[model samples]
Target: MTIRLGLQIPNFSYGTGIAELFPTVIAQAREAEAAGFDSVFVMDHFYQLPMLGSPDQPMLEAYTALGALATATERVQLGTLVTGNTYRNPTLLAKSITTLDVISRGRAVLGIGTGWFELEHDQLGFEFGTFTDRFEKLDEALQIILPMLKGERPTFAGKHYRVREAMANPRFRDHIPLMIGGSGEKKTIPLAVRHFDHLNVIAGFDELAAKIDVVKARCDDLGRDPATLETSMLVTAMVDERATPDLIPSGMRQRMVVGSAESIAEQLQEKVFDAGVDGVIMNLPTSVQGYQPGQITALGAALKPLTAG
Candidate 1:
């Protein structure tokens, strides 16, 4: 089993402008590739964290940033950590991803999810409905987007979305892996079992092993092969030795492969075999320490050697 290493491109209002973030992101992608990392994933947020001060602070859109990443890195795959389906029309979203896949020469993964951040929807004037409603919309989005990607002229009439003809431009284009994020037992996991090529969850080795069991059971009930769904985790980490252990949630810390290289490598191995995850999207809380891109690049380099071991 080959475990792939990936990093999350953090976006928050740390008071640094896009000038600070863009070049750093480019450099990090380049360095991750050089260091033998497999992928780089970014977030999709419209507003910065209010806890970070100010409501309308700096936040980069996911797809546009991914377009830039297409030119920045040669080997490392680039896409969202997970894009919210509520943010865009299904047809338009499919077109953007298809264009991105073309530009990246078949390296884009459509990491999508049912939108969770209520603040984003409220601030952006989009409907902040019940969780059920949002999941319904997400289901519809997946149905429309998948067929559109596969050269079908799709027409979906859901409670949330309506499409007469979903035709992707630069039509019948390349295939990009569809990765769904979240661990909602009812909707998200079932959707993953049905549609996603990969499923991402935020949990430790033991907890993840249990969740994978649940997913496998669901797959069995659906008469689908559990192996068809590749498993992954989105982990939060702090590399600084001085940092307190309680920075992130305890569950996340267990998933986080921090500390020295050897220790981190051991944790990663456990995450792979024990957790049953094939990949990890390391979420470096750089904003917490005002870390430069090179700092992240260094972290990527430090972990890169362990991928081969």
Candidate 2:
């Protein structure tokens, strides 16, 4: 089968009511399903980035929003792009995924990362530690969280977290796929090779290839089959009627897929063949005028023939 496709709904609406965003998210999920997209993901940020708007701008938490999404859509799989490991305790986070998995009928994949946003953690009163310290914590968190699904009461003590017989009750039906998100070669790729079911990198073909090579080598050294680990990318895309000179924004194309249907398809092919990516999660243009429903529909149409088995 061909690599699956996903979309990142960045939660970019102009409103305050929590219920208001549901319609947009539901619509996007439906669009993804209709377009034959395999999954739909949302950012786990507590606040909007400054470039997008205000730092204090409205945003939603990860689990609560995902719970609502679980009830809203039917076919499309859903989860966070990269949930911050420091946000919640590992057992609690695993339970949250368990609950969401049941609610969504086993359609949840856990995307996790070491996390980089200090401002959010500070503003929200979560401890912000050193880089190496965070990676250490992440490694420990994975060990604690992964076993909880197997009905194991985990006991782990590290420099950051010390857990004693943490119980995960009423486990979900399946082992929710764990996806590691980041491009760090030494630390992130090794962790992914050892623990995660998938790896998500935000880079072009060249960088993605290099990271994949690193992970593959690590997997080989660990006596693991590299094919067992899936690869995915997060891409910003602007889909208009046709390609134009100014269609793509500067300093963004390296991380984005822009232009006509043919151009976009070529990029997708490169990701699959060159970078060995198994899937892509496109971040569709949210703020651009006349791009929402129409462009989304067009993108779905363009990708239909390619995604069709």
Top-lDDT structure, candidate number:
2
lDDT of 1: 0.74
User: Could you tell me every candidate's TM-score relative to the true structure?
Assistant: 0.88, 0.91
The lDDT, on a scale of 0 to 1, for candidate 2 is: 0.76
Residue range 1-309, candidate 2, lDDT tens digits = 123678888755634255656677677778777777878888888988655657776677878878887888787777888898888888888899888888888888888987778888899998879888788888888889888877788899877777899876665664888888887877888888888888887666567777778878999999999888888887777675476636566666567677876677676777644576667778776644422665566666776665554
For candidate 1, write residues 109-196 as lDDT tens digits. Answer: 8889877789889878878798888888888888899988887888889888899877887742546788888777777788889887
**True-vs-predicted CA distance for residue 195, candidate 1, Å:** 0.8
lDDT of 2 at 217: 91
Best by TM-score: 2
